[model samples]
Target: MSSGGSTALKLNNILIFGLKLLVSAGSLYIVFSKNDMHQVGVTLTRIGPAAFLTASAMYIVSLLGATFRWKLLLPERFTLRRLFSLYMIGSFFSSFLPGVIGGDAVKAYYLNKDAKKLSLTLASIFMDRYLGYVALIGLGMLAFPFSLGLISGSPYKWAMPAIFGSFVIGSFLFFGLRLGKRFRVVSEFYEYFALLKDRKDVIVKAVLISVFIQIMSFGAVSLLAFAMGEHIPVKMVFLFLPIVSTITTLPISISGIGVRESVFVLLFGLIGVTSEAATALSLAWFFSSFVGSLPGLAFYIRHANKPEVKNS
Candidate 1:
């Protein structure tokens, strides 16, 4: 690529980052302006240290479960310890450095450096993310019937189903129809899927592990709500959290800052939760996960410059 082209790409990235920052700030302003900031502060204070610690631990367990799921897609030579370290580093980058290289890309780069199979490494990373989403959406679908009373009049009544339908159709086309096989550059990428198509055992195990990971995430947030003296039902958390998680995954806000809080308030309000309580819960959950990601900084500092050992 020419210098001019590279510079244009950099400028484009900067513009996108600026737009996301603006959106986050604007949404946050709206959320705070409409809610009682004093109440939000009080709700946050209700969470004790034990609750925070437990939530943080649950978040870590979810990360570990995700590590195990990712491992199922890769070669056995990669140890859980190594992958967990990489996962934490990825989390740190994702939480601390938005609009930069994404956590998935960071994980792929490090793993590819050691494995020396860029295509397979990238494929595994993609599949790991894909399967995780599949499980999340599946859980949401399962909870949808039970949640209709809560979401009856809300836009999410249709939005959740629409999201699931799109995901199902997209997955079928990509995996069943082999959508990108004709493209030379991506043919190798699709080949990995072809190879794994018959590996039902691996895929099932990965999805099951992903389910466990999502449950742990839900449990973490529920613990936070409980800490605040909110008695949100477990089923409600199961239903609402997946929708919140899916929406926030979109690259619309900075690390899902404003978007997450808005969705939390909207969904939990149906269950009679105040905006203050919902926002506090959302912020507390993010903070716990942020704390969980901190160990990644230490791992990065210690191992980032270390020599990569090629697995035989």
Candidate 2:
């Protein structure tokens, strides 16, 4: 019976994978069907030696941010070089997974081997993920109006309010739970607040790292725009890219191939750039990932001999 159940589960996953592939392919077809491949080539051709350097800079900056953020999460004994290696491999590892794994499992595994505390490891991992969301929220809401002026048609018109509401509701829950714990009104909520109280700086560092990560991604798009000869404001591009990035990270498409291009096309076109240009820009953005992954590949090659992390 167990064998039968396992087989059935495998079949279900296979079916789901098939459907996701179809949807991703169909979306890619739709996006490409509307534009000229020749023009995309032209756009790529226009990117010269300087663009490569710009892309390298963007990738390096993002890599540094990830390294720094991960380092902050570790206990003091861990060296920067060790954290850097793990950070690079873990990030590259996420790209290989079906969804954005984002290094939590791999990272936690190594940290646990050293610290051996389930709570500390888990707390830091959750805190790391939480900080990123908080930062993303800060970037969107705090600078919404100024950023909106960058593009002509914001495809994500609901983006600011949606993220804003999430932050507000989240903040309320956080404060409400803590209040309940401190006053002994609802001692049941104490565990959650206790976690926070024990680790005061995790949340702050996470928020800061999240902001840094968002900025790196936002900066990439602006550089792409610059490479493509677009003169849009950095603030506007920063806002729209994050919203678009959230859409791309949805895991429905392969590396967000079609969806991101579609969003860029619609949003940029509304701002008077031709669909061809928008398509070109989006394609450039997609290929840039391959460039960014080069260092990650090198890091993995050097570190594969390490033992697998025991799960907490």
Candidate 3:
């Protein structure tokens, strides 16, 4: 495209983006008006500083694990500084956009250009996520059996199918490396799995770290609930939060706001928790996550003087 055409497109995008921002601001206002902010504030008052501190610690732990994980995925020749910066930016970006695009794209772009093994880096990042989700399922299973008394009576009784399916999928990924002839379905799967088999020493370590990240995050949420003085057991989050997190990870609702709020209320409602309380907790979790990314805005500000690889 010509320079003039590129400039025109850029201007058009800016206008569209500004319009979307206005729409989002308006929507948030509407949602806020309809919401019971008084109850939300009351609930917030119930939560103590210790809980906030724990959540902050949890954020640090998660961010550290992600940075370390990305380091492992970096090409042998890649710079650690670049990988770490990307990880920080990625964590910050994930807080904004729905799903994982913001951070995932940031990491993919940087790793592709710098790592020199773009495909492997991509596969590693994805597999890292796959393991993280599977670990969450594992964590949830550990939590659910004891909380069966809380969950068995709810609509979440459908969890059997979900758990069974996650197991089957995880098993397939673990053992599917041996398949050769049926490579067309997903060649990357074969290669990545094969790499894992060949590098069990490294792969196992990465998976463990991913699991730890999930545990810390789950603990963080439960800590907030506890600090809020809710009668709900910590064991309850272990049981249902993984499922909720997994649901929110789905691409349906924006940033998983509606889906997460609905799940928090629905799942915890089994224990007689109020929908308002659920909404408050969910918002708190999101607020912490968004606040945690303030450092990313710092990074962007520092780098503003340099030419940006604008996402467009």
Candidate 4:
């Protein structure tokens, strides 16, 4: 890369990072302005250290589940421990740096540096993320009818539209990609798609692992809610969190900062939960995720000065 090009890329990243922070701060302000600050404070205080630790433990479990899923898609050359280290490094970048410059890119960067089959490594990472998303949407659809029974006349009456909208959009995208294989313009995408398509066993295994990843994720969140003294129904959490996960992934906010809390507040409101509790749950969940990623920083720094050589 030329010096000027490098500088331009750095500047672009900085600008996008700043914009993400601004969006997060602005959304947080709006959410906080409408809520009772006093109650939010009280709710935080009421959450004991024990509950926080419990949530952190669950977060660790979730990370392991994710690592397992990612490993399922990679070559045999990559060991479980090595993949876990790579995942941790990615998580470190993802948590500390939000927006376009995230852990996914970091994971791809390091892995590609050493990858003989760069395309396959990259495709593995993409499929890892894609399967997780598919599982999320599948869970949402599974929970939709049940959610309707639980969400009558609530502030979140509009959730029905959002849920159904996501389903329709996902279906369109799925079929669109399937049909897109015929076009030369998107041949690269189809190349990877075709590679994975022939591996039915790998796809099935990864999809199953993806389902476990979501279960662990929802478990972590449920533990956080439990810590906040709110017993949100497990079924309700399943129904709504997929929608929340999908929105927060949109990159409109920094690490989903304000968007996550706002969604929690809205969804929890349906069951008469206080905004304070909802906000606390969001923060707790964030903290657990942050803590879970801390080990990645050490791993990243340890590898910072290493020479980039392809693994044989």
Candidate 5:
């Protein structure tokens, strides 16, 4: 790329980052303006250090589960310990350094550099993320019927179905149609996809593990609610958390800070939770995950300057 083109791309990224920052700040402003700050503070204070540490530990366990699922999609050459390190580093980059380089890209870059098989490495990373999302959507759909009474009259009632429908259509187009087979790059990617497709056992195990990881994530959030002295039902947490997780994945705000808080207040409000308590719960959940990601910083520093070794 020419210097001018590179400069233009950097400027565009900067602009998008600025917009996301504004969105996060604006959303928080709106959320706090309408709720009682004193109540939110009080609820947050209810969470002791022990609860915070437990929540953080739960998040680490979920990351370990995620590492196992990703391992199922990769070659046996990648050991569990190595994969766990990569996962931690990826999480650190994702949670701590948004807009710099994405966690997935970081994982792919390091693995691809060593494995020297760009297509397969990239495909495995994609599959790891894809299966996790599939589990999240599936869980939300399963819980939708049970929670209909809670969202019956609200506009958000259709969100789960709409999201599921779109996912189904998109999946059909991508996998069924094999739309990009004509392109060399696309065909290379498809080669790895075909290999994974043939391994039914591996796919099933990965999906099951993904479900487990998602549930662990839900449990971590529930722990935070408990810490805040809010007795939100476990069923409601399972039902509503997936939807919030899905929406927060959208890149509308930084690290999902503002978007997550807004959704928590809205959904938890259905069960008579005050806006302040819900907001406190949301912040606590993020902080726990943030603490869990801190180890990735150490991994990054240790490995950042290491020379890459290409496997023959």
Candidate 6:
């Protein structure tokens, strides 16, 4: 709240933004140096409009699943329809804004407006995100065997160990929450975990919904791959998408601009996919996701004039 704190925050943001831009540009440069721009452009041009539309539709359904998962975590004060709109607004910020944090901030703003218990509401949001990620890794592990053959000779093949390592670490931390009761931060997180554990049925339903959301995301990307004349296997998609999603979450790029393309080019190359086609697929996924998030902008604008109430 102090001027010095504000200045420090601004400097930190500027530094982060600069780093992201540099990383995005650097990754793109590396990818482009080894691939043909003209061919990639050609591949983009050949994609069917129908396929793109269908992918976008699938993305919309995935958004709904995401909303449902979050709703399961909330109390009776929030409705699914209302939460879905908020989620879209969050998505809009995520797509147009810089990083993952902004979107969640937006969601928090809307939820906190009507929430009588802001801490619980915030905890629900955190759990919703955590469960979704858990579902992604769990599904990725399920698809790992199929993906193993796909990753056999890629330069980034070590990504396998790295991914599993993260999962293992995450598991350890979740269980270790009990050991941090004296720490304020970990105590709050542990309380949220306890809240979820009390409702085993809700946890099950939320995880299942999260899995469906992942499937829908995979379906959207797989459709684009098919449209580009590259019939990507379902299991293969399960493997690479989680990795791509995980990498993009690093906040080292602007919405993963160049990072996604580079990962696609690297991994798809092993499966005989041309760099051009792979880039096209990545672009298609981005467009569908961005389009899906556009309504969030409208929602945000409409909500802008609404009066805000202080959290209770």
Model 2 ranges off by over 4 Å: 96-105, 108-123, 147-156, 170-202, 306-312
Q: Which candidate leads the pack in TM-score?
A: 1
lDDT of each: 0.88, 0.67, 0.69, 0.78, 0.86, 0.82
Per model, how many backbone clashes are there? 0, 1, 0, 0, 0, 0
Stretches off by above 4 angstroms in model 4 are 1-15, 154-186, 308-312
Top candidate, metric lDDT: 1
Candidate 5 lDDT over 78-184, as tens digits, reads 77777888899999998888756789988988888777788788888889999998998888888888888766888877878888898899999998999989988
Q: What is the Cα-based TM-score of model 3?
A: 0.78
Positional deviation of 145 in candidate 1, in angstroms?
Answer: 1.0
Instruction: Kindly list the per-residue Cα lDDT of model 4 for residues 1-312, writing each as its tens digit.
Output: 999999999998889888888988998998899888888877776668777777676666667777888877765467666678788888888888766568988888888776755566777887788888778767767777677777876656566457667767875785455656566534555576766678899888877877887887788888777766788888888888887887798877788989999998888788878887888788778888888888998888877877665544
Could you tell me every candidate's TM-score relative to the true structure? 0.96, 0.79, 0.78, 0.86, 0.94, 0.91
Alpha-carbon runs more than 4 Å astray in model 5: 309-312
**Global CA lDDT computed for model 5:** 0.86
* lDDT tens readout by residue for model 2, 1-312: 699999999898777667766767787788789888787778767767677567656766776776677567655456667667666666666556534344667766666676676556665666556667667767877667775555436556667668668667877786654554554434433454465657768657756777888887777767777877776566666566666677776767665667888878876665677777778777776566556655776877776666644332
Q: Write the per-residue lDDT of candidate 3 for residues 1-312, one digit (tens) a residue.
A: 999999999898667655555544554555456568798788977877667766876886687786776566443544545555666677777776634356878777766654455567677678767777767787777776688776676777567447758777767755654444355435665666666767776667777887888878877787777777676787887777777877776544455665677677778778888767877788778776777766776665555556544231
Cα lDDT tens digits, model 1, 1-312, are 999999999999899999999988998999999999999999999998999988888888888999999888986479899899999999999989965768988898889988788888888999999999988888878888888887688776776688898898998888778786887646888877778877999999999999999888988988999989999988888888878988888898887889999999998998899999999999999999989899999989877678888765
Quality of model 6 by C-alpha lDDT: 0.82
Candidate 6 residue pairs in backbone clash: none
CA-only RMSD, every prediction: 1.3, 4.9, 5.7, 3.1, 1.7, 2.5
Q: After superposition, how far is residue 7 of candidate 1 from its true place, in Å?
A: 0.9
TM-score-best of 1 and 6: 1
Backbone clashes in model 2, listed as residue pairs: 131-206
